[model samples]
Target: MTHTTHTTRTTGHVAAPRPDVYRALLDPAAIPRWRVPAGMSCRVHTFEPHEGGAFRVSLTYDDPASTSGKSTARTDTYHGRFTRLVPDGEVVEEMEFETEDPAFQGLMTITTTLTDAPGGGTDVSVLHTGLPEAVAPADNETGMRMALDNLARLLEHPG
Candidate 1:
């Protein structure tokens, strides 16, 4: 049988320096605050920020019946490692879902790049490749966008 995979990309501009944005992306504590999409909550099971370090996280739908989850009825759990981290420029991770379904089996790669914007702040671009067939491209893009929005909000204002 031939294997197939999909890809999704999302971009956003945050009113913060590249260093700040890069820090937030690597901080385990900050992940749950901004990496989750609307209608979902995140939990960091394990995290090690260094390159080659492992991490595990789970995203659960606020409403269990909202959609089918890969790990459970309401949660999508995944574990991966930091493949590469270039200080204030980029981050690369390789992950796979914790599931039994054949449709959700694959090694996915997430590449996040940060660059300076014309006026100010940082331009963040995220590319997700090797997505499983069951994961809709539109939904994945939307989720990534929402997460970027959340990150922007978190950095633009501090209370």
Candidate 2:
């Protein structure tokens, strides 16, 4: 019965306005497109992008054998509620895994801030807190970086 609190932060620069970046974060279509790390795909089961709203997301690994080690399936499902939201400013949410594993128990919070950069670009950064000890810090950093990179790519070059 061990408990730990960890935090991981990653930032990206996009040639877009804060509103656009904020929209993409809460948009169902855009979330799955950029929120996942390499070799992983995201599926938004349900999303209500507002304060006090809830969301359900599934992250599936490309490889059948790939798993979070705490979840039984290759696809880990998480459900949480939006704790707070400030348009063109910040988004905050809290989530917990749906696994029976002890290591994956407890809640985690993710806060993303969108601000105006010096050149009209948007500075987006996400801070994930309360990460369980089951997940390594290095892995979390790499995964978060990948997700941010994807977000930047999509926001910088949108159709």
What is candidate 1's lDDT per residue for 1-159, written digit by digit as tens? 555889998999999999999999999999999999999999999999999999999999999576678999899999999999999999999999999988998899999999999999999999999999989999999999999999999999955
- Per-prediction TM-score: 0.97, 0.93
Taking the tens digit of each residue's C-alpha lDDT, what string does model 2 give over 1-159? 668768888787888888888898899899888989899888899999989999999888888877553555687788999999999999999999888877777899999998899968898888989987777877888988888788888988877
Q: What are the clashing pairs of model 2? A: none
Candidate 2 lands at a TM-score of 0.93
lDDT values of the candidates? 0.95, 0.86
Candidate 2 ranges with C-alpha deviation above 4 Å: none
Candidates in order: C-alpha RMSD to true structure: 0.9, 1.4
Candidate 1 is scored at a TM of 0.97
Clashes of 2: 0
